[model samples]
Target chain A: MPLDAMTDVSDEALLVLFANGDQMAARALTLRFTPKVMAHAYRLLGNHAEAEDVTQESMLRLWKIAPDWRQGEAKISTWLYRVVANLCTDRLRRKPGLALDAVPEPEDNAPGVTERIQDHTREVALQKALNQLPERQRQAVVLRHIEGLTNPEIAAIMEISTEAVESLTARGKRTLAAKLAGQRNELGYSDD
Target chain B: MNWGIAMTERKFDPVDLDHLFARVREHPAQPSADLMKRVLTDAYDAQAAVTPVTAPQLPGAPWLLQVFRELGGWPSMAGLTTAALVGVWLGISPPDGLVATADSFFGTDDDAYLIDVAPEATFEIAEGFLQ
Candidate 1:
């Protein structure tokens, strides 16, 4: 199948293609999921290299599970979120390190307005504050805030109740508020 | 009650985090080409692992032989040939041997010959009707 031919195909359907050994499905899925997976892993691990490794490993698991993946039971992205979160949790447990030292670089160096530069600054500060949070808190906050997932979705990914998700995110936001209190003025936020 | 801290917490609605979240969400971390290549390679490897391999067709074999090969191969063909040989043997063998086998199946030798679908009177009735 042509690579673009799968553009309209659902992720679950694409996995079916992957199960059938269709290389096009592999390419299409990789192209589709890699960026989000990479960004997500980066947000969790905060190390580009480790995130890359996690992204690759997560995708490897996905490919391997294609044969037995039960369609309609779960969304591919949701399953991926669970896998990525679990993998990140394992790595963090294995070696405890703050993401402060490894703030991500801008994805590109495109010349743009000064606003983007400020946005980058704010992003770095946010990541630093997020890194200071407990892992569960950070995962919840990132999923709820950065990834824009709903509480219910985060609950599914984190394997927790929605109430738990709400608590984690609320506490996470409070801690982030404390950490980001000073940077607010510099990050272009004004009471006015 | 620490109403002071509670009051402080209530007042501190989180600062506008939308900007920060937007920056990260908008620019997804780019995956390196090497990583992409490795991922696709793994996908292909897993695909190869799961896909069943079919036996290659034997070269220069007749279709009939191939059909037989598919139908349980040599053992089944041997059994079928043995059965056909037995049938041919029974068909061409002398009537005496067939009668003996029939007698064994029925009862005594006379009983094998005596067993009939209908009496001779039935054949006469059919002949008279035709006339």
Candidate 2:
């Protein structure tokens, strides 16, 4: 199938196609998911290199599980999110006390120099604050705030109740606010 | 005016977390082409493992077994099993036409062509020719 034609197909169906030896399905899946997985892993791990590793490994696992993938039982993104989260957790556990300051500034040139600097600082501050959050809370916050998933989706990925998801994200935001509160001026956020 | 003090005092209003962290989405880390190639190769490998391969042809297999294998090994076995069951059922209750059909198709009576050649008749013919 053409790439555009496969765009409308569900991830589960694409996986089934992939298992059945359709190379186009594999291409479509990789094109659709690698970036999201990488971003999720990056936010959770706070290191680009580790995030890339997690993304590749998570995707490899996804490929391996494609044959036995049960459609309609679970969404592909949900499964990948769980895998990336667990993988990131393992990496974090192995090397605890990861330094957030080492995160390289993202490359962007569309915005003005001043705006880019402010955005980079805000992002760095957010990453630092997110690192301060407890594991589950951090996962919830990133999935909810940064990844822009719904509370129910976050609950599914985190394997927790919707209420629990809400509470975690709420607490996470509060903690981030508190952590970055002192740097408001430095982050370019002026007082009202 | 300090936000951290407000949060400590339980008086801090919830900030717009979505808008605050939106920059992260704008500049996500991307997988390099090398990583994409590696992933696709792995996918192809897994796909190969999942797909069923054709069984290699066994040289000098019996025709019957070959027929069965062609129909898919299991289906061929099933067909043979059904045939055996029907044969057993016929043995238990022979049909009227079955006897006639068997006699016409299998009986050797009045079929001289199927009988063995007489050795005496061949000898007599050879002796007459020699004389």
Tens-digit lDDT string for candidate 1 (A1-192): 565568888999999998998988989999899888988998888778888989999999999899999978988999998899889889888878734444544556667746776787887788778877999999999999888999999998888999999999999988888889887788887775
- Clashes per candidate, residues 3 or more apart or on different chains: 0, 0
Model 2 ranges with Cα > 4 A deviation:
A1-5, A101-111, B1-17, B55-74, B77-97, B100-131
- Candidate 1 chain A: 10-residue stretch with minimal lDDT: A98-107
TM-score of each: 0.72, 0.76
Which runs of model 1 end up more than 4 angstroms from their true locations? Answer: A98-113, B1-11, B56-131
Tens-place lDDT digits, model 2, residues A29-68: 9889998998888889888788888998999999988888
Give the Cα lDDT of each candidate. Answer: 0.84, 0.83
DockQ of each: 0.52, 0.45
Q: Supply candidate 1's per-residue lDDT for A142.
A: 91
Candidates in order, interface RMSD in Å: 1.6, 2.0
- Model 2 CA lDDT for position A31: 85
